[model samples]
Target: MEDRRRLLKALAACAMPGVAGTALATPASAQPWPVKPIRMVVPFPAGSSPDLIARLLTEKLAAALGQAVVVENRPGAGGNIGTGMVARAAPDGYTLLLTINGPLVTAPTLSRHLGYDPVRQLAPVSLVATSPNVLVVDARLPVHDVREFVALARSRPGVLNYGSVGNGSAAHLAMEQLKAAAGIDLQHIPYPGFAQITTAMVGGQVQAGFMVPVIAMPLVTAGKLRIIAVTTSGRTSLLPAVPTVAESGYPGFEAISWQAVLAPAGTPAPVIDRLYRELVAIIGSEDVRAKMRAQYFVPAGTAPQSLRQTMASEKVRWDKVIRAAGVQPE
Candidate 1:
């Protein structure tokens, strides 16, 4: 009986460890993930489109997560500086990136020495929004529609010049795609930003180029510029009368600027899942939708996998466009 009692005591001690091990493996939800403030890095200037969207969404995300979500603008090197910062950040879900396709897709192909590989370094959380680019010409130009503009460009060849934010920018790529499809020769005049591009276009320094509706519509309405076509699959709500590039002639011409959220690679799956759910809810809310529409943006709260696929596909598409456009990085 003494020996049997000794064996029972040993078995009980072993069983206690198993029970403790199970407790230690408790689900991640029970753990306080974001016990403190979270930082959302926007790889653009403070008042830029990406920054504005980040500020809008962070307010709602903070409320949902019960923590402060701060927007830090670390703009430089065409958004690479902020992007690389997030890519190298700890994968504890404390730091997030709210960026556009430029850094993730085009810049990689344009720049030979980009510090971070977006697909390899960042885990996609969600696609926040997408906005179409409008092909607007100077009011003084004689073109009334896309066909007319193409004809005029063909007739003038390299004499007509178009402006873009810079080489390999979305505007630049869109125009390049257009040039390839329409088989016209137009000189590309790269500027520092959209403001400069718009200024040049309005001043008749350049003939035409692609621009977002928010910037181009005001000028178009003011009789400074004329939108020949929109570069999306469908017409934008902001300009219902404007035909899409596809509708104008080309079949598969779709160029759009998009914004998405991402976390450092190896971020805990539970945290990423939680963030995605909150982001989807926030994006679907009426207030967010209204605000997005007001800014001429189409709100798109897509799955993480969707964003990954989009990044992959865009990288391939832009590679071809950039090569065709003959845009070399500085």
Candidate 2:
């Protein structure tokens, strides 16, 4: 309500004699926002899930905002380098970030030199989508489910290794939390991205991992990997046959993979509110929802407060797991 009022006041100021002229004389900066291309930064590799989703928004957002929404991939340091770039960018609403929870939640707890504080440096736009991670292992592994896998890892202890895209990634933290809950010891191997992790698992270099269904399904379909259980609190509809880690034995386990859009902190509340509304509408559209579901994501066009709440809860949840896992900051 306050933001709407402020926006209205700004517009009404234009009606005042000489205010419009003064705004014009002040330069383009004084003009209406989004007069030029807006950059949407994806702190992950091109063609990754976040990348694809960012592209999905670009087309519609360009039309909706009457500006080119260009996507720039700035992948490195577990999504920190690019994330930090957006965090430090001028809060003029021209730059934005479409990233996952690594930098937002887990990395803060796990990385010592992380340059950005997500809570203080970024403002929420909306929760784009959420997907449960699936625990999968190479087909040749003797484990059939989470129980057997736990037993196998327990039997081997530190000998069994798991792969993740990078330290503090959702897959990394999910497996770490599982290791804590299941009382098993597994080595952590960081890969470049989802594809590399899958390749390593298929080659038998790493025994298992927790990854989104989009990346795990094809390997499972080709009989190169076997599904164990999901990280969600309950069984997901996309893979109903697989039980959740919580149901398997641990009663309250839940590690969801989610993505969100954010801008530098101190961005105008009016701009933030406008972004939140537009993004929610874009994600809620039938075509967007259908494609999101096809990629195994549950569309979540939630409000800014909802996104902030989820981030806080996830930080608390992952903080305990990261500490328990004894993953030292790098």
Candidate 3:
């Protein structure tokens, strides 16, 4: 009986440390994740809308999580370079991506050999914001509204040229979609970058082009460009006087440039959910919303499932538009 008691006591003693270890594990370590800085990669230049929105949200996020959120610019390949980087990054919560509509939706459609599958290789964190594309013309253009612009382009055909930020960019596709919908044939002149397109539009190098509201609003307000139509489902608060393309004639025309946050595809569910919770909070904050509006963007914080649906729908729609426009990949 004594030997049996000693054996039982020894077994109990052996199990004590294991039970205590489990109990004594620090819950703070598990709960207080993101002990280090978070890096957000932006696939565009510094002053671009994506960069502006990223900085705004990062500032708030950093403050909330007690970690520094740094933005790194990785512009190239029409946003593919940076996007690819994020798609190939470690699934840890530290690395993330901030990208616009083209990289997330249109690029996958246009580029047959994209290195990463946007839907399958990246986990959508949140929809940051979106800006309507504004159809802007040189201040010296002869047309004042969409009706006259279409008439003038139809009359001139291939003579009246329009500038695009790049060949497969959203701006280019928006203009092509408009042309297809309106049955007007304007010459497409591609520019190396958005800055050049703005310069060309302002200098009368190209008669008109489709640009994000943030990019063209200053030009319009300063009287360097004329806003004829906005490519949104409805009129924008920033440019309430401008008519939508649908209202102009084509009843279902809408082209918007949007941005979103994503992490690598294999990121753990725990990490993804945590990041998403924080992101939704950051994006929906009054300060972040105001900053986005000041940049001529509408706050759009969508869940991962919602973004997945958006990607599927947008891919189908943009594919048809690109095919109709006869856009060949570079």
Candidate 4:
């Protein structure tokens, strides 16, 4: 018995170094988080605003993190498909979603059966950028400003039609908000995407619509479209001469589109912190700011908590607008 006890004690003592070595080395080995390439899912088509922003940041992020950041376009179902992909992705910081306000804030209220809950399944990393929508009309239209447009609409109710990217899109909601505030009747024409909406507007299929500054400015400059008013409370630098919808007649009319970065829920806090820091740095940098400004996107790198608050507040805000607009889920 004595010999057996001594032998057992000796074996136990011999195993201590190996056990301790593993316990100490495990965390060290895991310290470098991005051991592999990271995939950023842009829940919009390539060349879309959100995708452009993602591609803009990919190289910087890759350089900073020492890993290849791949931007994948997965556009479908008003951005729900790609968003759901990221929501269901593993919470290891390997996958992320860079999207606009439509999917994160408005879609839940618009769709009855979303596969993933953004608030519950995704973690906010940063609010990347924001840009106001420009209300533009076909150059052939007689109206030149918001009031003129309203007058024309009132005179020819339902005769003047507006096109939007989709039913629940920001463009659609902005028009609905305008209709409610201005008490004008205009027909709503829903298109599959922005390209189609631009085509319809140019072809005179629709006389007017709200569009992003990047798309509207070129058309306006080319005499294909005319900018009547911007959606934000203040005029954009891109269209400094154009008045705002609020200034045109309505006082509190403001509908700004924004983009943000998010990860699957349960992502490590440290990883989230690192990403937030890097993103804020990148967004706030002069070069990135210049690029964003060239695209008419206002650089905004809000903290995660602020973004969360914005999400909650926007939900309440859009809910009222959508309900007031009488937009029902499809």
Candidate 5:
């Protein structure tokens, strides 16, 4: 019993005011945060939008944090592998998750057997950006507008198909949400990645698809695909001519994939606050804004509490859509 008491005293001493204060203050002047390179785990393969953003953010964060911020891709099982890894990783503010909507919100509701609970295992630090999906159809499609497309899909039922980046992906869920709201019956086709979605979409294999504007915009400009509407709350400045789906008659319709930084749950509040402060500084820079604009994402550096609220609201929203669509884990 005496030995146990001594051990407890030793642990308390380590966290005491003077000792804890010194250790925490060591990373200031003549010192650097993350004396070693930090790793940003991306749950998708390279070249994908999320992966590209992760790399961009890593470069910027590395510069801002005065350490190399490396990105590691562990793509598999619809992003479950990498996401689970970060969820169980050390909460020392060194390892972080740079990802989009799936692993954060959709995966938990869809994959009932997933190893980690997103809400319980991770905490949001900062929101990087928000990107809306663009609704585009092959040039050969008869439909010309959102209304016409809805009519055609309703008439054809399962004949006309829409492609998404992958099953349970943000694109898929967006389309599912659209279908429910419009009461249309279009067939859903899943692709392995955006590359396949592009190929199939341009070749007329899939009549329509939901893809990021940056990617589909080039095809639309090339006359390979015709963009019908922007699936966001307001018209995108990039495509000023395209009307938003909400304006097209679907009230309260909005689907956006937000990228953000997150640390594992149980990370000390001070650590989270410090990281958030640094990230906000970096994200607010004009250089980072330029990078985000180049990638077709709107810069949105929200507070930690605001990001948490957004996540909770998003979970509630997607949970309804997933359940209504009868989507289940594979």
Candidate 6:
């Protein structure tokens, strides 16, 4: 109360003609929100899919907000490191998070030591984009499709290894679910990020894994990697030629990966609302949608309530997958 009175007095004194230049500088509390550059934290390594998308989106967001929006990579712990950072950040709108499903929905069930509860600490803004993970193998593996790969894995058991960013990542859960469905066994290799996974696959450190289309397609095109099936129930336009795992042999199989914007829980409703509105507009724009689609992403400008529901449903879906794969919480 006293601070408020001081601010009013100072502001009023500034209005006086002769005192305008002499009055104390406006207090930070009196300044409008976004008075400075806003930091959009991406909890993944640079050049990762989320980083690519964040770079694309923050450019427009900065212009829209009339403030610079800088994307900072806080990669590690399958996105938990950066996610926990944002979860613990001050709820002042200056710090924001753009992340994927790992730290949001799956980690609670997959990781024994996950340090943050996304449900309790983060406020959903909107789901930014959605994409299916593509099942890809090193070109040397010689498996043509999901059936061939599963057969090989079933025969080889734990001999075949796959890589993912970390536990609770889309690749991790997707492969585990596929393994359980196919009754095959493959060893899991966790890397720090997809870039490392891609490198490892190219180097033949691992045999097969799931990847975003944007990252998998280039190598697939170059003959370094062979993409067989997508994790979606149906094929995506980015890889329309690629059949889905469900279409191959397994039924009712899906593992869709997505990105969403969020603020720390207890952030002002106005800030969340404004961010949501701006994100929806930017994502819904034809040009932005075109770019996202070209990159194999489908823009999902859902309402905050809708995103919350997505998180809830995904949590239920992955929980069962985790347990079925015998992934005990650490």
> How many clashes in each candidate?
0, 0, 0, 0, 0, 1
Clash pairs detected, candidate 5:
none
RMSD of 4: 2.8
* Alpha-carbon RMSD, each predicted model: 4.3, 7.0, 3.7, 2.8, 5.9, 5.2
lDDT of 6 by residue, 1-330 (tens): 999999998777776755463444445326777889999999999989999899989999999999999999999989999999999999999999999998999888867778889999999999999999999999998689998998899889889889998888999999999988899989999998888998998888998999899888889889999999998887777778889999999999999999999999999998999999999999999999999999899888988889999999999988889988887665
lDDT of 2 by residue, 190-220 (tens): 8767877887888889989988898888889
In order, candidate lDDTs are 0.87, 0.88, 0.83, 0.88, 0.82, 0.91
Question: What TM value does model 4 have?
Answer: 0.91
Model 3 TM-score is 0.87
Worst 10 residues of 4 by lDDT: 13-22
Residues 96-122, model 5: lDDT tens digits: 888887777787777768899988999
TM-score for every candidate vs. truth? 0.82, 0.89, 0.87, 0.91, 0.84, 0.91
Local lDDT at 51 for model 5: 83
- Model 6 gets an lDDT of 0.91
Best by lDDT: 6
If both were scored by TM-score, which would come out higher, candidate 2 or candidate 6? 6
Query: What value of lDDT does candidate 1 attain over all alpha carbons?
Result: 0.87
Candidate 5 Cα misplacement greater than 4 A, ranges? 1-33, 268-270, 328-330
Distance from true position, residue 310, model 6, in Å? Answer: 0.7
- Least accurate stretch of 10 residues (summed lDDT) in model 6? 21-30
> TM-score of the candidate numbered 2?
0.89
Runs in model 1 deviating more than 4 A are: 1-31, 151-161, 203-206, 324-330
- Residue-level lDDT of model 1, residues 290-328, one tens digit each, is 999898899999889999999999899888878876767
**lDDT score at residue 113, model 3, on the 0-100 scale:** 79
